[model samples]
Target: MPLLRSRLLPQLQALLDLLLPPACPLCGANLPQGPDQPPLCPACLAGIRPLESPCCPRCALPYPAEEGTDHLCEPCLRRPPPFAWVAALGLYMGTLQSAVQRLKFSGAIGLDRPLASLLADRFTDQVREFEPDLLLPVPLHRDRLRRRSYNQSLLIARVLGRRWGVPVACRSLVRTRDTPPQQALKADIRQRNLQGAFRLLGPLAGERVILVDDVMTTGATARECSRVLLTGGASAVAVTVLARTPRP
Candidate 1:
């Protein structure tokens, strides 16, 4: 009975697909349903602009110039960040930007799977090299979490952790204060805004951690969180975000 059911399941799915094709989550384009059907349509996938070279290797900041080699940006040179580096799927614009905003602000949590899959696909090699001990999502203050009813970062982290076979620690690092939203603040003020906002739940034993977030703009939040994690005895930290706010 089990073997028969397994064989019939694919045929049943195929019949259903032929009757009603699935649509892309980002753009609503009709998708060809199959075992290998992508979560997003091809056009939407192409629209996601990758964070290319000629940018800061440390922060993944896209350079204004059209072309050059990856190098340290001025900020990294002047004041090094606590995290070793950042890995992102794409710049926060176009399709990627729309997707992030929808997932974050519109409560479209289903987007987490596709976004995390893309990030994992892009950085699987780098992650393997980093060999992080755990995946940690930047936490939201309880107040905000209560209002939103979800932490987008945590959702993404859960998906990535499962995909990468890494353990996820949801409460290892937490937002102790409900800091004002970073998007509304100036770049310089962003860091100040997040100062002492996060706290490590407990000491670590030199675990390498991959900090996960939905998007990164000034990186102030990531920097502050990394500082706490490092101080709490994490050996090293690397940031992974779905999108990076492109420099204007």
Candidate 2:
């Protein structure tokens, strides 16, 4: 029966594909069965540069190893951001940039699972180490959530929580003030823009929490969340994100 089921599986998938063809949510390419269902093609996937070692422990910037020195990157060293620690899956350039763009702007919401799964798979151990009492995603203003109908950060937090055995509190944090987008501002301006933006919704006493976000560019948003969480009586605040844009 097992062998019969295995043999019929491909045939069933073939019928399904023929009936309703699948396409890459990013590029709209026809998605075949087997390994092809993972969304991004090999060429596109290969362009994603994962953040390997020799990175800033605080900001997660991929840095070159120097002689007998393990220190911060320029952006981290010159003016450190507030988070206690950070871990990222990859660089926010090339294919990763486009993938996030498609997911966030183009409304290709189907890609969230694969992307979040990839992030969870890579950071499962680290997520455990972060020892988050509860997973909290950066909250979107009601207006933005109404327009997008989804928050990719929460999607990622849910996926990571399931994989890492950490419970998620979806409404743990609230965005009290609706701020403009962070992508258009300089680091200093970004910091000011995000200040007093995040606040705790319910009781958060002595909990070790980690803030989950889709991207950490200037680290301002995460820092603001961390500050809010700490002020709310969280013992420690760490950040886990999908990408970190290195200084150009």
Whose lDDT is greatest here?
1
By summed lDDT, which 10 consecutive residues of candidate 2 come out lowest? 62-71
Candidate 1 clashing pairs, residues 3+ apart or interchain: none
Quote each prediction's TM-score. 0.96, 0.83
lDDT of 2: 0.81
Tens-digit per-residue lDDT, 144-248, candidate 1 = 999999999999999999889999999888888998898888898999999999999889999999999999998898899999999999999999999998886
- RMSD (Å) per prediction: 1.1, 3.5
lDDT at 201, model 2: 78
Scored by TM-score, the top model is: 1
